[model samples]
Target: MRILGVYLENIRSFRKGLIVFPPRGITVIQGEVGSGKTSILMSIAYAFETPTGGRVEYADAFATPQPRHLLRTGESRGLIRVLVKQGNRLFLLERVLQREGDRVVNSGNAIYVYELLGEGGLQVKPVLKLRLSSGEYIEKLRSLLGLVEKSGRQRPEVFTNIIYSPQFNLTSILELEPSKRREVIEIALGLSRYTDFRANVSKVIDAIGEKVKGVQLELSRLEDTLRSLDKQGLQSRVKKIEEEKARVKRELEKVVSAREKAEKELEDVNNDILKVNSVIQEKRGLISRLQQENRLLRDKINAVKSKLASYTQVLGVSLDNLDEATKKVEEEIRAIQQRELGLRERLNALITREKDVIAEENRLDAEIAMLERRLGEVESDYREKEGIVKKGICPVCGQRIPHEHGLRLLAELREKAAKIKEELEEARRRRGVVREERSRLRSEIDKVQAELVDLSGTKDRVREAEKLLLELKSLMERVAEVASNEEAIKRMQQEVESLEATLREKKEKYASLKNELNRLREAERAMSNRLSELEGELRTLNDQLQKIQVLEEKLKSLRSELNKLVNSREVVKKVADMVDEVSRVLAQETFKFVSESFTTIFTMLAPDKALSIELSKDYEIRFYYATEKGRGLVVLPSGGQQSVASLALRLAVNQALRAISPRLKDSTLLLDEPTIGLSRELVARLRDLLNKLDEEQRAHIVVVTHDTDLLEAGSTRVRLVLREGATQVSYEGELDKNYRAFVESLIEKPP
Candidate 1:
């Protein structure tokens, strides 16, 4: 695809602009550095691949920070309507980037994009739009040098343009790690499978080593634990049993002391009975004295009554009356005496009763005291007896309590006495109680003793327990001496040992496996390395083969081309012999080509001292008069000469490309600052070249420059100047009667 013309507005350095491209040949775009020469090239790259290749706004390609600022700061939108030619069809690639713009893709207002094509004097919308669907446009555009297709290890245009090379990175390329170096080399050589193989091999080797180390560590820990288990044996049981036996012996002493206390209480109750008997005797004597006194008083009162009766009888006459009165007196006196007698008798009876009661009470007290004393003595005796029994002392005081056991006899005696005393005390308490109540209490006491017997019958259980403990201790000791019988400790030790052994076995197995796996991995790594080497060699051979194939094809084509020159070889040889003359003639032709019409342009743009242009076999340029005389092309000190040389070389390359093949044809010429080092006369000669092109060729030429010295009458002139706060395009075409007249006015005026 070829760009015939572009109507650009408010693009990067072009503000409010419309510039057309000529169809072919050298079309110089004389411009300063900030002018819109590169803008035209970028516009072509954007319009073709807008979504992926370039920014949406052409101003985004510059330092303008925002989209709104791209359009003279206040203008709302920008448009670059591109007129492109594909094959026989001419189509428009319009790109409109607005802040609030409606979406028009490629060159249309519809959802589907279309390109405007000119055919038969009519502008028709063609299906060859700038979209993924337009594969043909991409292919044709790539055929021209405008579109670049990068492949393989070639850096993409994006990275090359965006990334600058630093010295550190350049040095680091040689200082890469072994693996990293291999990786970069693999990438450069395109060895994809070998890279994956080497990575897998490294992982396998690391995994095997990890497994081996883990197993070995586990085995070592297990062996250490198992070794300590053998020392923890079964001698602890004996010490534990001896401690228990001593505890039981201490408990038996408590039982002995308890029995002694019970006996002492019984003795105290018996002593109280003895004291009561003595009190009963003293009360009996008092009862006898009171009874005797009562009898004497009654006899005396009876005698006195009889005496009174006799006196009354002896005194007759009035004595009868007196006697009667006396008798009455006697009777009354007798009655009073009788009453006193009766009172005395009652007092005696009361005293006797009191004595009897006292005696009885004393008896009871004595009995209770005796019983208590007896209980105490019995308890003391019982304690003594129990002590004798436990110490194996004699209980009967004469015969030793033999194999039957002295403690057993004493214990039996104490138990029987205790039961009898308890019954006796119970019976004494119920001395005046109902027979049934006494019987019931006795029965209850019996029941309690029976329960005690039942509780004590299992006393030997503790002894049996002690015996069993001894047996256990002996068995444990034996087990320590001989290993099999000790199940608990032995089993634990065995388990620890088994674990140790198994861990050792596992570690050994892991070691073996790891060794095998290592060997396999090493083999695999070696194989991978070999494969990589082989593949690298194969790729090198293939690249060499491809180069050789390309060379052979080139050689064949060259020979075929040279075959055409076979008849002209003599002429070519003659020309080759006169190389110096040919060189001189070529230099003259180059000078003539540049100094003829374009010399005036170069002279005007350059300073007065240096103004000439040098050309070579490929139209290579050297700034001679532009800087210093006979200065090499590279010796141009100013950036302006470099810009001029760049512009000239770009034009020369396009021309050569077109001349080589019609398929390699390019119609657009973007000359950036073509008249940077030229005089007004040289600029005028260059202006003639610009005006000399035919209308078809003129349609494709777009000159972007700050220099106005090369403006001509036939060209469409646009002047870029800062207005308000931004750049705006003004038509110099209408500034004067002609473009040359308008541009010359400034130079014509005094500096």
Candidate 2:
């Protein structure tokens, strides 16, 4: 914990700075490139992690500028101050950054942390507070610059001493990138148990690739439901609806046999009108007895011609004309008294007009004998309506007779008894023409010769009305051939009962549609055997998911090639035990001053070129070449003698780190120009090994040079004199007055 003292203002090239380090050995702050001399070792590594000299931004070894552009950038504001000493406990910290309204306020809020304690020896003074306000005095100046130490009990989890090895970068260790150089050498070798075994095998292969993508998405939805149940036919459509219900029940039956032969020809015209109504009641009783004997034979022929004309006129006269007449009628009784006095006044006017013409011929012979007793009561009602139409109905109301309405009422009663027997044969032929004129006036009376009596009952009533009209037209043609064979057996019994009721309803709807297509073909054969046993268990889980993805890519390439062969065999056994502990601490601290500073920088840069140099165990430096008689050793490619044997072994590892913490580490030695490519006699033998250190092994020997022969081995010299932008150092204590005024400003070659 050292940073003895440092105070800076506007920090970058450090404007108003002051420095002091004298706690032990080296304290060099040589200036050259941009003349600030690594700004006094970067202001003591930014006051050893910002005592309060705040802007080390959080220390990757300090770079937090911009306190208003660290002041000289057109001047804004910046300041940094630091002073510390832990053992004797003196501390003074101050840091302030600004750029207010636009903000970049490092906000150490005008910090102040003082602690100068000494008490008995009486050097006590400060006890001030605001130590970087809450950053706890920059974490107590990073635990008093052991940088951040305190974890003792073997707590080495890799914090390589806040390493700030700047200069040209090693490309962060030879430009990493071999898996980031095995993650920065496993965080510089802490190796956190192989990074938790590669993060638990990448979380168990991401949960087994999400359970193999959910078993291949449920086997692609059961193979699309077994290919839509084999492209849908759905079982033959129930046998074409049972063959169209057996052809519409054979056809309805011949229309029921023409409606039963028009009801048997209307029953044979009702038995030929009941025998023509009994021959019209026997011709109406013979025309009512010839109209009453033709009015009694015309009243006996006018009584013999009226008594022969009244005896020839009462015996008087015209006897002379009658003498010939008397001779024949005295003679004919005078012609029957001229027809018996005209038939005695026509038999007294025919018995006084036959008593009203025999009372109008017995009132038309009692109206033709009451129309022949109403034609024998219409022939006993036409023989009881022909025995009620041969018993086929209507006896007085048992109604059937439509044999064409009983043959139209027996031809209208035989035309009303043949017109009353032809008006009784024209009244008996006018009574035989008045009895042949009274038998020729009875002069010859009784000449009778009547023998015409051959009436076989009028030819048996006209041969029984022509044999009952030929048996009613042969019983109406046998009832129209038995109603046309009972209408062809009721049309084949309604086509065999409608094809047995459509074959019993198509065998009960095709046996209930083939038992519902055998329960949908056993649910499509149990969903096609459950989609072929889930596609053979998804093809045995896709061959066990491709053998667990090729055994998780060969277990991630054998755990990244076994963490790169166990970090290259632990960085090659920690570079072979750090090159045997750095060659036994460089052979106990110098190794003959690193083999005489690489044979005096390769004999001042390749004298005759059979060069030689070598060191290993990781601090690495080698060069070899051989030809003249020695075999070929060949590796001498002098990049300026390997930059002057790596700047003289980094100034002998900064004087062996001030011979190991000469009091907590700040022995500084920074060389920037480093002799670009050494030549001037190898830069005067690298300033003759930096003047072979003496003043307590060169306690404050700072030497930065534009090579006026290494500032002529300056005891104390300083000279950074830029002009217009204002920077001036120019001091001298010895070096023969700053090496003869820096060799007269380099031979005045101010070209």
Per-model TM values vs. the true structure: 0.29, 0.21
RMSD of 2: 50.8
* Residues 1-751 of candidate 2: C-alpha lDDT, one tens digit per residue: 4444455566666566454444433323345466665454444444333222334333233222224434445445665665555555555556566566655455663233334444432234444445454356556554544432323212111121112223432122322334543343233322323344445445544544554455445445545544554222322322332233233222212222332343343333333333333333333333333433344334433443344444445444232242343344343344444444443443343233334433433445455566566666766777777666776675556877666666567667667777776675665555555555544534322211111112333334334333333333343344434445445544554555545554455455545545554555555555455545545554554555565556556556555554555455555455555555654554444445444554554454446556676654343555676776774544554556666665654455445444544443443344544556678877776665556543436543344445556666555555564455444555554434332342232212111
Candidate 1 wrong stretches, greater than 4 Å: 1-45, 48-79, 96-120, 129-643, 663-666, 692-699, 719-751
Q: Which candidate gets the maximum TM-score versus the true structure? A: 1
Judge candidate 1 against the unseen true structure and give its global Cα lDDT, from 0 to 1: 0.45
- Error (Å) of candidate 2 at residue 480 is 54
- The CA lDDT at 530 in model 1 is 51
Output the TM-score of candidate 2. 0.21
Query: How many residue pairs clash (N, CA or C atoms closer than 3 angstroms) in each of the candidate models, in the order given?
Result: 70, 34
Model-by-model lDDT, in order? 0.45, 0.46
